[model samples]
Target: MIDVHMDPQVLAGLQEVMEGEYPRLLDTFLHDSEERVKALRTARGDTQALRQIAHSFKGSSGNLGAVRLALLCQRLEMASAGDIGGLVDQIDREFAVVRAMYEGELRRVFVG
Candidate 1:
């Protein structure tokens, strides 16, 4: 099983600074992540496209403290000479786990 954890310190800092915009920030990250995952799934055998997508996804996920997701993206980005399909599948599965965690966090913060 993959472990999913968001950085509490990063989240607390965002909440401190973002204030009312915190929910929106969460929503945006979730939405953008969905799009990036789709792009990764549809990248086929295009290494350039896959690398570009993974690099961008890595930076944003790291910014939001999704450390595991960012690390997965980093692996995908560096796998220009290996099995791209396998990495994409791994990313898809892992993103599902990460997405669930983020959604739960959003509810805890916004709905509770």
Candidate 2:
């Protein structure tokens, strides 16, 4: 089976430290990730820019326990050295999954 998208232990630890700010933290990650993805999509032939964005994004995703997303970002970062175009679609799809999962998590934590 695939590993869980967001690590429960990490989330629990974050909640313990962040308390009521946990939801805001999630919201900030979601918003910033969305912008990073958008910039990645539009970066086109700018390999240096793509690599920089992917590098930063990978760290944040990993911190948030989105291991798969971080892996995808790593791939994109590496691919930026060569054929970044070929990886764009895959990155977009994986990010869609990540976005949906995080949105669900946000609703669960903040609304439910």
Candidate 3:
């Protein structure tokens, strides 16, 4: 049962590959992603800025196995001045979910 929100295999690979730093990596990605999501809000309605923010956010999200959110950002990256507000709202919502998921993983695996 793969969640559309993320890829468990990718997350597992990152955990294995990163060794002890996996927690920190998730922490950094979450922090950086929060800023990017906020930037998307602030830059809404500006096609150029939205594309740039979405592009970077897409890369980071993909790297972290945020499958669905990465796809949302990809859509935003290619947006053509159509429903920018709606797309930003979608990205904002997705990021919130991703952050919570990662935070939960941190607490359960790292803290327990």
Top candidate, metric TM-score? 3
Q: Candidate 1, which ten residues in sequence have the lowest lDDT sum?
A: 1-10
Model 2 segments beyond 4 Å from truth? 1-4, 80-82
lDDT of 2 by residue, 38-101 (tens): 8988996799899889899899989998887787778888883567876666567777887888
Residue pairs with colliding backbones in model 3 are none
Q: Give the TM-score of candidate 1.
A: 0.90
Q: Candidates 1 and 3: which is better by TM-score?
A: 3
Which ranges of candidate 3 are over 4 A from the true structure? 1-3
Ranking by lDDT: 3, 1, 2
How high is the lDDT of residue 49 in model 1? 96
Candidate 3 has an lDDT of: 0.88
Clashes of each: 0, 0, 0
Candidate 3: tens digits of C-alpha lDDT, residues 10-71: 98999999989999999999999989988888888689999999999999999999998999
Q: lDDT: which is higher, 1 or 3? A: 3
Compute each candidate's TM-score over C-alphas: 0.90, 0.87, 0.93
TM-score computed on alpha carbons, candidate 3: 0.93
Tell me which of candidates 2 and 3 scores higher on TM-score: 3
